[model samples]
Target chain A: MNIYLRLVYRNLRANLDRASLFFELIFPLFFIFVQGFGLNGIVPPFEIGNGRVISYSLFLAAGAVTLTVINGGTNAGTQLWFDRKNGMFEQILMGPFTRAQYILSIIFATLIIGVAGSLLVFLFAFPVLGASFNPSLSGVLTIAAALFLGTVFFGAFAIALSVALKSSETFQIVSTFAFFIFLFTSSVFFPATSAPSAIQVASLANPLTYTTDIFRAGLFDAMTPTVSLELGILALEAVVMFAIAVIVFHRIRV
Target chain B: MGVNQLSRLYGDKPAVDRVSFDVERSEVFGFLGPNGAGKTTTIKMLTTLLQPTSGGANVLGFDLKTEGRKIRERIGVVQQQDSFDQGLNVETSLDIYGLIWNVPRTERKTRIEEVIARFGMEEFRKMPTVDLSAGQRRRVQVAREFIHDMDLLFLDEPTVGLDPIVRRALLDYLKERVHKGLTIFFTTHILEEAEYLCDRIAVINQGRIVQIDTPENLKRRFGSARAVEFKLLQGSSEALASALSSSADVTRLVQDSGTGAYRVTTTRPESVIPEIYRLAERHAVTVSSIYIAETTLEDAFIHMVTDDENGRETERGLG
Candidate 1:
């Protein structure tokens, strides 16, 4: 087996514990099941701007998937921090791996976990929201692209954060604050179109907003020129964040 | 393996100065040094973990700077830090390490069982590494390195937390491996271990090589003086101390305040022992016990380091 693949396997196997399973799978499932179902009665249906309408439950389902991918990215970056603390970072570097190979393995592992978690969320949400679901080939492609680019962006962002921070407590505090900012400012729960002007501006600047918008457009077969533009910007953000991550990670001492 | 003027600098200060050495195939070369004497720094550079500021090394036929991957693929390093997958059990951690080295499945399993039994880790094989004691964790960290094949192994203070039996077992295991054509570059603060296991020992101090020779040669070179000690039975040894100090063969003499035993450091113990008996009889003090103590590696190491420090200080004073 290739060294990168072996490292990816090691990462996946090492993280298959109960806490990781609950946070990566069960936590997001709660939002889809409890939050989505509870909010279905109070929140009205959304006019998704393409002559298509989506229930609040379906919108929350997309947000739940986005949350899973975000957690996966954070997990990917924090794994590096924990490995450094436990001395495995130097240990692996002393083995048959270069720095670039090690970082790439983590990024690739994040991608796998992100995609898998998103699919698992969709699978579990299908029974609850299957009545209003409509599928198309182009729609599925858009969702796949959104998930891929979103995972890359957030994974690189969190990795850069992890490498830049000196202590685990600071990383935890900052990442939690950053996650809340990303979650609330974006169109994950409520549409940015209906939100206040200041929030709308913040939502427009958030990558999560683009990810959630692209996901919603795909889920409701409401792809628009704006969604395409968001996809392009998300790709650019992913590229820049990944470059920063590589540069910062390369400078880390053994 | 050969190192030529290998040096690593932390900012303006050098952690490992321009020190050079070589290890022949199947040789257990011991690197003995005090704390912060650049042993770990040298090992890091040799193992390709840290880049040298200035200098070069060729390890296992690969250039240290250009072919680090090749060197890493062929060599194993047991670092001083404790490293293991905290969430994994002992068996899983060892198995995963073997997989990382690309060991074959059958061989990995065989080696895992062999090392577990050899290291007495069977009782905790299924326990998580996070819950193990420090000694148990260190044992696993060292044992996991043996699951793969390598030409040379670098062990940095691997026996720091092990018991006497386990420490001896690890030393014997390294000896057996060296006998089968595996070269080992070992570093430890324990001089006795170096004396017993190292074919040739290098004493590094203040980032420089002070001395390098076989264990026997080192002891002989820096530890030529023998200690002659005699305890008086009845009378005071005040008369005997004056007589022993006047002898030409005796270089230094000290009388114990509590035990009333007089110790004499001399070049010739045969001549000094007879003189001590004659002097004790002359003083009406009967000799109760007497013995000539041989020099040890620890004694030689202390003498060498202290002499090196004093020499440097004198040079500074002259400058």
Candidate 2:
């Protein structure tokens, strides 16, 4: 546990400076404003298929908060790549810590980063979008759980990709392409029901679509009938991705 | 530690062939070899970084295959390549390394300062590792490994980029550690380092242990042949070469390029020196300067490695 904490502390200390603050804190806020106001005037509000209407900015705020977590996960993988390239990976392995401890340190660190980014997004949302974060105990817990598990899911996905790709350049290109594709195919911008038939098909296959739905439902007190099923699928996907990450992490050679 | 036919095979080729040697307690065992010559491979197996392909070894009284973590806990390694956390300053890098080794915070603080002072790293202790020069980064890399207490240390060319003074300081520090009961498995291509530090030296070539003995003994054994070098004032069209070739003691003779000098190798430099001067006088050639030079350890190393390569080539031709 001491080793894990030291690894986490060092990782966070190295990355959580003012330069990172711009990306993790201020830059995400910039995305929220641009994503909220830029399209709010031009695009119509989403109906959400329940006879209740919300501004496109509010919908984008939900996606933007979740996007922060996803980006945090990718950053975790980038850190791993850097560690490997700079010889820290081999150095750590030569020490008393196990490979599992190192991977867990990365996952937990990114989870913290993701949660912090999400809170900042919500804090900015109240003033920028005039949105209220008032939720029931259950709603707050569900949103927090989604953020936690979503970070783990994306974090594991990123690590798996990092392990499979040899070069950081190739890893960066593929991850960027995949993140955008994941965002557009999901219900981040529009409701899944309102998306085109092709995107709906892709979104159904995307774990993010359910993440946005569960996340939006928790925040706005709008619960879908299939919320329980979406939560189950998301939990299962997170577990499988986490397991794959662990397996891949073990298989990596120093 | 004892190794019994330890080997590591990559595909069909053996990176470390069936080789065995022993390291006594507190011994500075030097592994000398050129690049791609299995020195690193052997170190990896002994340090628990790489497993042997088809052999057995005991490190610190623990089996290599079953008790890797036990071996790892007791050994420190400084790999040949440059490795440092670019995100960390020199001080943090040392601190984190101590933390990983489970060194208590109070003791860790004391050891970090000691190593910093010992390694002359006070100037760059606060500098980020990436911002430091290659030699400074290497100093931090070597210094950080001493933060943890270990029974044995594996240093693979740890002094690659260090300045002469720093390199000598490192060697002296390591000698001090060895005096305090630290066993070191050292590897380097630099023969002088091996001569100065190693208690027993192993010269490996083509994945095999070509020779192993004390540095002085190996020198006397393989390096007994001396060179008699002399510059001729004029002569030597073929007369001196023919005259020196008739002597039973002269093993090889070659003329120096553009200097009109000939270097003659012989087991008896005392007798061969006079023989060469006599031959020059008889051939009506004037001698400019003559000196007997003892064979260096570097010469012995090259001679052993090249001879091994030639012997293997001859065996393949016969097969």
For DockQ, the strongest prediction is 1
Docking class of 1: medium
* Structural similarity to truth (TM-score) of each candidate: 0.88, 0.88
- Please give, as one word, the docking class of candidate 2: acceptable
lDDT of 2 by residue, A49-109 (tens): 3455788888888877888878888878887888888877776777666778889889988
Query: DockQ of all candidates, in order?
Result: 0.57, 0.48
Pairs with backbone N, CA or C atoms under 3 Å apart (clashes), candidate 1: none
Least well predicted 10-residue stretch by lDDT in candidate 1 chain A: A13-22
Candidate 2: segments with Cα more than 4 A from true spot: A15-21, A42-53, B225-290
Cα deviation of B227, candidate 2, in Å: 4.6
What value does DockQ give for candidate 2? 0.48
* Model 2: TM-score, first chain: 0.92
Q: Worst lDDT window (10 residues) for model 1 chain B?
A: B231-240
Interface RMSD of each: 1.4, 2.3
Report how far off residue B47 is in candidate 1 (Å).
Answer: 1.2
Model 1, B108-135: lDDT tens per residue? 9999999999999999999999999999
lDDT of 1 by residue, A1-254 (tens): 88888898887776445577567788778887888899999988868868888788888888888887788788777778878888898999999899888888888889988889888888878676774667699999999999998998888888899988999788878987998899989988889888899999999878899888898889888878889899999989889989999999888877
